[model samples]
Target: MTILVTGATGTVGRHVVRHLLDHGRRVRALTRHPARAALPAGVEVAEGDLTSAAGLEAAFDGVTAAHLITFGGDYRPLDNGPRIVELAERAGVRRVTVLGGWREGTLEPALRASRLEWTFLQPVQFMANALTDWAGPLRATGRVREPYGDRKSPPIDEHDIGAVAATVLTRDGHAGRSYHLTGPEVLTARAMVAILAEATGRDLRFDELTPDQVRREWVAEGRRPDLSLFRAFSEVDGAGQADLVEMLLRLYGTPNELATTVTGDVERVTGRPPRTFAQWAADHAHHFQP
Candidate 1:
């Protein structure tokens, strides 16, 4: 089966491609700049756009399924996801998996309304996102300054997200399912700092800042991120994103014969356990070092 993976070079999409290729499936990776797409050797790289459907004619050709990322350009997944899925259906494709959010327009509604079998992957938060808080400063001073020191969350590993996507794309019985995926443990920023410190054998500090201080710092750094997004980072109702984190812990202990947790889902689908935050840090130590 030829699977076309959009956002083929991103954190999640690269894993999707790698997982598919590891399973011996034919893969076609889509990117705007084909020259820059550093895909695996056997996979085909096609130049395409998810915004206007201008360069996607050949992308869907002979593709039996597709992994769709909601962004391409202008963040118009509402306009483009259906068009691409329509093209896939026209080419007799059977499955479509979407990496949810990260797009301006809603692609879920369009996917649900289509005839194609589909799965939505909504991870609560990526552990890799934590790297943004620490990696830059770690390279400079081995310390991270951020707001809400006690905030905790169940962060999903990006590789696990990819494994689940590969399962939904390649196998059967996953259609019409929306998976709220997350990690096995709920960890605080301080707790994770300790983990990284342990892994790298360096003293890493999590300096707690007030929300106002964080926003001012970001503004000073020339990154005016949306206030709501920043607020979500600091919002701690006892456990910081606790509602979703609790749901994840509830799902984690369930039988593997039933619904999936972050780790079990990746293991069940990929035949490998999900990488932990420490493992991720160890693997990416170069990115954290001076």
Candidate 2:
């Protein structure tokens, strides 16, 4: 069966494509720029935009299953959900997996009302955020300055997210389920820093930042350079960098059950335990080197 993967070049989408290829399935990757996608050989790269369903006919053609992202470019939730669902239904697609955002988007409602088999992959914070948030500082000074040093969460590896998505899309009995995916263990920012330090053999320190200090630093920097997921906060109209910074600080500083809870959904779906933060750090240690 040919499965179409949207966001085929994204962090998790690339993994999905890889796992699907490993399973020896026909994969069609949909992207706005196929030339820049750089997907693996033997996969069809189709140029299409999820925001505008008018051009997705060829991408969905003959596809039996598909993966989707709730957000479009700049992490803004896609508003043309009904149209995309209509196109998918018309194309004879049978299954779908959505990598959801922090909040529900237009796509969920449309999918819920459709006849297609659907599963939601609600993953916690991605462990890859450390590369964007801490790697630069560690490379320069061996220090990770951030707020909420004690806030805990089981950040899942992006690879597991991809694996779970691939399994759900290819298998049956996953329809109408929403899996809250997470890593195998819970850890705080400081603990994660220590793990990275061990992986890189460096004395990395976690310097906790106060809310006001984080604001000042963010203002000075003029952008939220820490995590790509924070870009989702900019989806609001007229929301500036300062607004995004505040939203991120609130999210990281505050305690939330869903953010901190560890779940076995990844292992349950993929038949293997989710990778730990230390494992992730070890694998990507070279990126943290000076």
lDDT of 2: 0.90
TM-score of each: 0.81, 0.96
The pairs that clash in candidate 2 are none
RMSD of 2: 1.4
5-65, model 1: which lDDT tens digit per residue? 9888987889999999987899999998899888889989998877767777788889889
Give candidate 2's error at residue 11 in angstroms. Answer: 0.5
Report model 1's TM-score to 2 decimal places.
0.81
* Count of backbone collisions in candidate 1: 0
lDDT, candidate 2, 11-67, per-residue tens:
899999999998899999999987788999999999888888766988899999999
How does each model score on lDDT? 0.72, 0.90
Sliding window of 10 residues with minimal summed lDDT for model 2: 221-230
